[model samples]
Target: MTDIPLSTWAAMAEIIGAGSIITGLLVVLFQIRQFRVQQRNAVAINLAQTFYSPDLAQALSLMQNVPDGISLAEIRARGPEYEQAAITVCTSFETMGLLVHEKIAPMGLVLDLAGGIVSTMSRKLARWQEDLREEQQQPSWGEWFEWLGDQARAIKHEQPPAHIRLDQGAGGS
Candidate 1:
């Protein structure tokens, strides 16, 4: 200690300071990566809801209202408005082998699963934003509203076209 001069002490302090800066930068990078992954997962779940869930709901609704003995032709005739989206949905389900009653059983189950995914993602995002707010010591209202706007945009952009006319008008056009 006696041999060390004031210059050495200054240099040591600078090194420690630089080390801390590097550590902070690394933490920021890790956090950014984690956020990106979360956002991607959310987007993917949203895409699934857009492309699959609505159609599944419509199909299920149609199946429920149709008399067990009704002809497909009659059903189609009654559902002319839904022809395009319905056909697309039917084809998509057929390709995925999900159109069969035995396979799909309860469409509600599929919708419930999708809903759970969306709910979980929402909770995670809220928690993340809450943490960010706490860390930054700032109110989160603005960020929350912005996030909501983004979600609305995503839903608006991705929602499938209305299809499958329910006799009771269960599926809104």
Candidate 2:
């Protein structure tokens, strides 16, 4: 047998509206997180495809077979075949670095895929890369390769790789 005051009704409406706004914001944040996860997964899939490409596979094979710190002169003596393989591998790592910097690709996944490969290649090619930089008179060249190596070294992992964990997520990442 009582009627609520007009101001009380208005206050109640305001509280309900605030709750609704908070709920909406929460939803937006969740969706953004999910979108990032999906993007990371897509990037990982794209990376896998890149790895399986004929040229890339060949380049990777060459990289693995090459001894650490192999001299530029030796690589040149082996001829353009080795040169082309190094080019392919380094360029690929450069692209991966860009993706990681842009956050389009997950850092963890990038490291997981071939962290050691990149690190080792970058180290092996350090002298050659510097030579190219001097030859071109552009010190900025191959910065991406170095950047990717640094990113890879910065990540710490134990047991299975991060990509495996991402793939095994309850949902499709």
lDDT of 2 by residue, 1-173 (tens): 45989899899999999999999999999999999888778889998788888997887777677776666677787889887888888898999988888888877788878787787788777777777778779898778888897666566334455566667784674
Cα error, candidate 2, residue 88 (Å): 0.6
RMSD of candidates 1 onward, in order: 19.4, 5.6
lDDT of 1 by residue, 117-159 (tens): 3222333234433443575687742342334334434543464
Q: Quantify all predictions' global Cα lDDT against the true fold.
A: 0.46, 0.80
In candidate 2, stretches whose alpha carbon ends up further than 4 angstroms from where it belongs are 71-73, 150-173
Q: lDDT at 112 for candidate 2?
A: 72
Summing lDDT over every window of 10 consecutive residues in candidate 2, give the lowest-scoring window.
153-162
Q: Which ten residues in a row have the lowest lDDT in candidate 1?
A: 96-105
Instruction: TM-score each candidate.
Output: 0.35, 0.76
Best by lDDT: 2
Cα error, residue 108 of model 1, in Å, equals 27
lDDT of 2: 0.80
